[model samples]
Target: MALKRSSSMKTQLVNGIQLQEFEQEEEINTSSSNNTPSEPAEAKAHTEPKYYTVEEAVETIGFGRFHVLLFVIMGSANIVEAMEIMLLAVVSPEIRCEWRLEDWQVALVSTMVFLGFMVFGVLCGYVADKYGRWKVVFGGFIWASYFSLLTSFSPSYGWFIFLRCMVGCGVAATSQGFILKTEFIPAKHRAFLLPLASIFWMLGSMLIIVLGMTVVPSMGWRWMIRFSIIPSIILIGLFLFIPESARFQVSAGNIKGAMSTLDWIARMNGVPLPEGELREPEVTERGNAFTLISPAYRRTSFLLWYTWFVASFIYYGSVLSSSELLEKNLLCVTDADAEHQIKHNHEEALCYCIPFNMADYQTLLISCLGEVALIPLNIALLNVFGRKASMAILLVLCAIFFMLVNICTTMFGFTVLLFLLRSVVSMNFNVVYIYTAEVYPTSVRSIGMGFCTSFSRVGGMIAPFIAQVLMSRSVIWAMSPFAAACVICAIGVVFMPIETRGRALLQHG
Candidate 1:
């Protein structure tokens, strides 16, 4: 009876153990089935990012009415900026005559603008990258237009200088505007399209000349400045139409905003996103203008800044000194009697004179006209020789012209050589803008440009004093430094390791 009871207990215990093993196996299978598709799909949905690059966005958005409208409206800002720069030249003569201001004081008024650029350029750039490109555009234009208009009403030289300085501080948006345009353009078309902005710059300067010929002589430089605001006021209202950079929005982790921008771009471009979703561009950690100095970027960053300084030194140095250049040429053209006869008709006397001195407005107009050829030349040179070759060659050409300005003795020779010099230097300036934008990554593009431009403003601030001191001795003294600068920058271009031609914009430096 005891053996029979023990056998029944053992059978029951084994059956219970087997049942427990079977239930455990069934539960594991059920969990695996539930997780394999359901959890993995959910995890992937959660982990994968949606983002796009500038090039991809360009492909989707393309060059169409959207681009035309945006860039056109944006070009208005460039026009405003150009007018501000040339305005110093336009008003300097009148201010000098009216205030009985010394040559140094006239130069100081111009120098103050660049000084403001030196102070505020990097700050504006940082703000553009940290905040938004459109904000920089609007902010710059608003500051520039308001102060510029107020400048026309200045009661004294001190007030005029301060207001003009504010305009320079505001016009630092040139770098921001350049980057903003680049971020939207397609890679294949970038080099060609980017130079088109120069045309608007040219037009803005030419507008000042038109004012000089028509209104400036009759009314005054003040009225000309006030009249210049009409277009700017119109442009400010249109700022609402330009879109913020989708690339910037994405890097900022604003996915919804990026998407909304991308949708508008895609709708205009008539293309779908890659794999039905955008993927974030791979980038290093986010940083400020100083980030450009990191080990990876140090060589390129310093190189660009130095080159920009050199270019600005030569370009703005030449521009700011242009008023005096005409005076030098006039020495050979007019005797005491001719000068006496023309004193009353001086404005009308040179209105159409071939051998006459190039007035400040005329000099500025000639400078602007030079940009008309920059676009086509940029297309050919950038496409054929690549960025390095084009920039180096252009700088060399500029150097040759600067040397000619010193060598030439006659009025015709000075005028022709000076015109050519302005043209070549303008081309070089456009090249620098294109190259700077191409080299830096979107991560710090605007600030990087601003940093480089800020250094250029350093050169600009010193340019007037240098030109003033040098011109008193001889034109050669003023121009020699710029010739040396051109040579130095030309050499720098040869040493650059990267050529950004036909490549997508770098995501980060």
Candidate 2:
């Protein structure tokens, strides 16, 4: 009986072990059914939400091929605008002969134009921020075009000055064009593209030379003023086809419009909509003029304004003085008969001008070529070197070159040094625009840029008078003041913060 009981216990123990094994298997299956395949905790922790790719972001922001084309077209318009600003410089001799005016009177034409730029630049920024960029830009085009046409028909010097000032008021649209370009371009492309836009100004300078040497001399000074109207009309028509900035739309609380524009861009570029919703930029309660003076931006405003003044003082002073400088230099090289004839007859004046042959063209071309030559240097040095460093280097170099040109006696030495100085100075012109735009928050960017440009205009206005004073004595004497201006620019550059290049626009105080 004991053996039979032991055997029964053994059998029961085996059955219990089997039952335990089965229960373990069932529990494992149930857990497997309830739980997902375990992702490593580290992997889960590191996972990030995908944002749009660069191409996708560009499309989402409405920067497509069509937009690029529009940028080029508008850039050409900028070239035209610059041409108009320098127009008086080219024809100053003729205007002086016709009006029987003093050097100050010739200077007044630029002053009036810049004064209009100063007053209306702020107004345009306000309109651009509050209303829309297109309206201000279009209005400027129409206004400037009509007045430019009127400038061609002025019968008296007073009428001519009044019309030129009116043209200045109309040309306030140039600021709007810059505002649009800044708003439309993506952040990555902003710095490089913005500086490249200055190439248009150089192109405009070239156009002025072309017109002065060709059209104005062949036709009359009035025809040169008339030619200015063509660019305005063409640009106004092209602007009608370009859409308003999507960024501006978003800023103004028009998300639907912004999205629709984005959709078009996406379709155009064959890209998908980015995943996130668009966030509107904060709208400040500050008025346009007051915004520039607000405590948060006051220091920035002061610095940039002063820089503008200095830059304009140097740049416009140099540019306006160019015709006089060239004429004087030519006089040094030419005979008495040629000089006398050039002083009297408009056609003969330009045609038989000193540096009369390919030499003048070569000189102008070399100056312009100096601008193009700096592009690579900018690309290489601008990123690796900070804004302040690059600006300081350029400014110091410009000052050195200016001083060298002032003291040098040989024509070859003067031309080479002058070209180098201009090249260096031109780089600053491009850099300043990029710096001003980058430093300000988007909410007040246009205002900041407009103010900077306005101060630049003030410098331009003051330039002719300063040059007239200096040049009335000797070419060397005129350049002495410019050398001083260069030193001031160099000092300003040294004090500026080094945070502008490749930086996102800061929104906080």
Each model's lDDT? 0.74, 0.69
Which window of ten consecutive residues has the lowest lDDT sum in model 1?
Answer: 347-356
Against the true structure, candidate 2 has what lDDT? Answer: 0.69
Best by TM-score: 1
Model 2 lowest lDDT segment of ten: 344-353
lDDT of 2 by residue, 22-129 (tens): 999999988877665564555675674544332245535545676677668778767777777768777676777677766678788888888888888777777777
Please give the lDDT score at residue 32 for candidate 1. 90
The TM-score of candidate 1 is 0.83
Pairs that collide, model 1: 51-278, 51-279
- Cα error, candidate 1, residue 277 (Å): 1.5
- 436 in model 1: Cα distance from truth in Å? 1.3
